[model samples]
Target: MSTYVIGDIQGCRDALLRLLERCRFDPAADRLICAGDLVARGPDSLGTLRFVHGLGTAATAVLGNHDLHLLALAQGFGRARDGLDTVVAADDAETLLEWLSTRPLALHHAATDTLIVHAGVAPQWTVAQTLALAGEAQAVFADRERRRAFLPRMYGDAPARWRDDLTGDDRLRCIVNVLTRARYCSAQGDFEFAEKGSPGAQAGDLMPWFEVPERRSAGTRIVFGHWSTLGRIHWPQANVWGLDTGCVWGGALSALRLEDLHLLEVPCAG
Candidate 1:
């Protein structure tokens, strides 16, 4: 049985199917792990969601920022952007919303020491600490009443530092931002969502979360997908793999075989 970690699908179901076929994926025998952004910006959001959802126990996904945005819009917490034109506006949006809400912000595989998160981690957190913090934030979203109130407050940059005293929505927002939207962060661990371009294009003061010297997950193989601009980056010492190759922007869809570290990529149809 093989486990494959795929890059951001971004609703390019055909490209995803081709990559899976090239890998000879058997749903019954193989497991698939998606780095997230399973929908939006491409041709088939609904089909992509259905395909992944159909995988059932064979699949695991970390919630991407796009996925969270879809959830928020479905729940009426925010408006959809013009770029999100491909998302399904159907009655089943509620079902999609529920499934997306249940996804965890991060996943850890003890056997392989592989940690999968949507974006980057807070420089201050160890892998274990990040997992624990993710659980706390996930619990709030899991509860119906709390999630309704929490979604509105989910859109900010308050409580910049991790403080034990931060209560209510402030704390949850920080956790959500770190797990979902993070890319570059200040030395003090403050996230800057505005820097979406390639890593070198950013100001010298900002650093990629994984570049931090004391990153606790340095020993583990960390797989993430949000920064398509980074394309595929391999840090030998860090054991970090970035698979986002900008398929939504007509680039390539990529996947890595976890057991052997083999790469499989397919071009987008446009």
Candidate 2:
């Protein structure tokens, strides 16, 4: 049984299929771990959602920014942005929303020491702490009334630094951003959301989340997507693999074999 970790799909169903074919994936014997961004930007968002959701126990996905955006839009918290073209219209958005809400913000495979999250974690957090925090935020979204109230308060930058004293929505927002949209952070562990380009393009003071020294979870292997411009980075010391190859921007879709750390790439459909 092989387990493959795929990069951001971004709604490119054809590329996903081709990548699976290249890997000779058999659902009966293989498992897939998706880095999320399963919808938006590219064509066939609905198809991508259905295909991945159909995999059931054979596939696991961490929630990405786009996936959360879909949830927020479906729940009437926000509208779709210009570049993000969602395939789900008003009529069929409910099904997609329900499926997306069930996805976790992070996944940990204890046996393999593979920690999967859509983006990076706070520098101060250990893997166990991160998972506990994620569970707290996920609980809000899992509850019907709580989710509605939480979505509005979800968009903010306050509680910039991690504090155990931070309670209520402020704490939840910080957790959400770190697990979803975070790219770079200040040395103090505050998120810097303004920069979306490659790691070095940002100001010298800002460092990619993974670069923060003394990271508590550095011992475990982390697989993440979101910074497509970073392409693929294999860091030996950190046991980190960045798999975002920018399929929505005409780059290839990538997958990493978890058992052997082998890579497989499939060119995106124009």
Candidate 3:
């Protein structure tokens, strides 16, 4: 069986299907690992969620910022964004949100040494450490009472760096931001959320998360999305593959075959 790691679907159901066709994905024999943003800002958020959720064990996804937003909105903790009302209004909204809540912030496959996260990992974290930290955030999400209390506090860019001493909301926020929304950050591991352009677009000293010189997880193979402008990156030296191709922005839905590093893509209609 082959594993195909897909970029952010962001509600582009048609593109996802076409890309899967390109890969000849057979649910019976193939597995899909999504780099999050599974729903939002595209043609069919409800349909996308239903399809992905229906995949069950055959598909797994990391939680993207958009996915988390859906969870928060579902809990009445935030305003409804475009393309999300359909989800919140759906009959299966609760079930879908519950599935999303339980989804991991990071997924690591030891055999392929492939780590899938919605965005980037903290410079100070190893793959195992990253998963462990993710579990902390996941725990809050898994518990109904904790999740209700935590969702509102989830929207911020503060404490831009990771510290082992961090506790409570601050620690979980740091972990969530790094795993779901991080892109360029300082060598000191400060997240720069404002700069969303391509790699060279950032100012001095702000490098893509993986390029941080002292990044401890640099040795791990990370399959990530969330930086659409960065497009598809294959840097064997850095052991990072950036898969977001802006499918929601009228670019292409992209996927990478984990076994052979082959890429398959389908143009998006936006």
How does each model score on lDDT?
Answer: 0.81, 0.84, 0.91
Clashes of each: 0, 0, 0
Per-residue CA lDDT of model 2 for 27-88, tens digit only, reads 98899989978888888788888788788788878888888777777677777763343544
Winner of 2 and 3 under lDDT:
3
Estimate the overall C-alpha local distance difference test score of candidate 3: 0.91
Per-residue lDDT of candidate 3, residues 1-270 (tens digit): 999999999999999988988899999999999999999899899999999999989998999999999999888878888689899999998898889899999998777889999999999999889999999999998888999999999989988999999999999999999999999999898898888998887998999999889788887789999999994478677889999999889889999999888988889962
Among all candidates shown, the one with the greatest lDDT = 3
TM-score, per-candidate, Cα-based? 0.93, 0.94, 0.97
Displacement of the residue 150 alpha carbon in candidate 1, Å:
0.7
Judged by TM-score, which candidate is best?
3
Model 1 alpha-carbon miss at residue 103, Å = 1.0
* Comparison by TM-score, 2 against 3, better one: 3
Candidate 1, 1-270: lDDT as tens digits = 998999899889899899999999999999999998998787887788878888888987888878877776766778776345345476676666677778888899766778889888887788898898889877877777878888877887776666657777887888888887788877777777888888788986887888877776677788889898884567666688888999989889989888888988999872
Instruction: State which candidate, 1 or 3, has the greater lDDT.
Output: 3
Q: Give candidate 2's error at residue 125 in angstroms.
A: 0.3
